[model samples]
Target: MSKITVLVVDDHPLLREGLIKILSLDDDLEVVGEAGDGETGIKLVHECRPQVVLMDINLPKINGIQACKVIKEQYPETQVIVLTVYEEEKLVLDIVRAGANGYLLKDVEPNTLVQAIKDAVCGKAPLHPKIAGKVLHQFGQMAKALDMNNGPLLTNREQEIVRLMAKGATNRSIAKELFISEKTVKNHITNIFKKLEVGDRTEAVIKAMEKKII
Candidate 1:
């Protein structure tokens, strides 16, 4: 099996070293490169083209949010996980807006970070538990009078899947809850996004609320 290639980016030398060490313990993960600043991180991303990037919020040059945006725009397939200590709601929102695949704290357990990388590569948005609540809260505040004049309607199953999605449930969790396979859950979410005309889980939630579909 091919191991997941990762790039560690942070200003702190000790932290970057620690993260690389943790990644080394995982048989399925490989650290392809490391950087001490966001500019170098971005350059390394171009050079190494790792599968996932562990980005820190406070970088010397570009900063995590902007770097993440650059990566997503330039290489959407390369997942970026913001590994930061800042958990402020606004920072979470900013990182999410910049298209981070996951938001995890520096204090996260090594095993959890490893699992988060795997989950992220699998297309799951693995937010820290606290950050998850902020995203959910943002969705909660998004209800509006929907102009459904051209909006497509979702089937009952799609509604169920999306509702779970709004609750920040993973594909695995949604499948287990609905007694379906993960592939089936993914299919449902794909259909939901298509019907809702949204790009991601966050947009789907907001669109669902706008239509009062959930």
Candidate 2:
């Protein structure tokens, strides 16, 4: 079996070294490289081509989310698992939108962290239970709004557009994924905006979530 190669990225020297030490104990995992900041992390990830990247959100040069975006954009095969002290829902949502596969807090046990890495490598998202609960509550609020109407609404295409837009995907990316022309996408977006009574993508997504359209 091929061992999983991982790149550790943290602004703190001790944290980076500590994560490497923790991950090194796993027979199936290898710490291929380390970076003290996000820019260097991005460079290392590109150079190492690791299967999994354990990254910290608070970095020096750039934020982890931006680095994840760059790395995932250039190397879609690489999986990033955010390791940080933050438990903010918005940050979690942002990182996920940026293409991170998992989110693990720094307080997580070494064994659990190792398991998260393994899960991420296999394309599974692992979130702390508390974090997951918070996410569920967020979804539940949306669900409640969606069920508020007498009957279900929103066509499948509108739903798709909202989901992509909510995740901060570019119109071009959405068009490619939906296999629609850019003009067609713009047309659909306009229609979606009109139906949602929203003027822009951000507002549209907010409205869609409130209606459980996504």
Candidate 3:
């Protein structure tokens, strides 16, 4: 059988080297390329066309989430498994939306990580247990909130954002109204999405209004 082609993308030189070293010990796995940033990772993806990509979230130029999105868009068959230290709920959802095949933490055991990469090539998600818990719990909360017709219990600031959203206000407009940065507005909206279990601003607004939370 041909070795499973892989690419390692991370901002830290040490981490990238370390992952390469681990993969090197596996006879069936091949490290085709390594990149220190997401931009280089994307470039190398095209050049190497690896079967699996081990991606990190923090990087200069383009972030791993955006890079994963681009890569999956262009090469839907390519498997990108996010390997990061972040356990943030929103980051998990973001990467999931970007079409990551798996989510593994930095502290994963070497054997487990290796097996995860192998699983990715076979079209399976070998999500870290903690990561899987968070993803499932999030959806569970959303489902329960929806079933109970109670909504996700938005914060005061999040309610303000949703009310503005009902008026079709843009993120910039909401930020200006709240005197917070645009990124803050976006984050608040993300929370709103989680609470309400809605996908976009329109859906969020409708849910909030129907529940009389706005």
> Cα deviation in Å at residue 161, candidate 2?
19
Candidate 3 clashing pairs?
Answer: 152-195
The lDDT per prediction is 0.85, 0.80, 0.83
Model 3: per-residue Cα lDDT over 1-214, one tens digit each: 9999999999998888999999999999999999999999999999999999999998899999999989988887788999999999999988887778788999999999999888777645678889878876766565555644465577888888887765546677778998999999988878888888865554565566556575
Go through the candidates in order and give the clash count of each. 0, 0, 1
Off by over 4 Å in 3: 145-214
- Candidate 2: stretches off by over 4 Å: 143-214
Lowest-sum lDDT 10-residue window in model 2 = 145-154
Q: What's the TM-score of every candidate structure?
A: 0.80, 0.68, 0.68
Kindly report which residue pairs in candidate 2 clash with one another. Answer: none
RMSD of each candidate relative to the true structure: 3.3, 8.3, 14.3
lDDT tens digits, residue span 84-179, model 1: 889888888788778787899878988899999998887677788887887667655654444545467888888888888766588998999999
Q: What C-alpha lDDT, on a 0 to 100 scale, does residue 203 get in candidate 2? A: 52
Q: Please give the lDDT score for candidate 3.
A: 0.83
Q: Which ten residues in a row have the lowest lDDT in candidate 3?
A: 142-151
Q: Pick the candidate with the highest lDDT.
A: 1
Q: C-alpha displacement of 48 in model 3, angstroms? A: 0.4
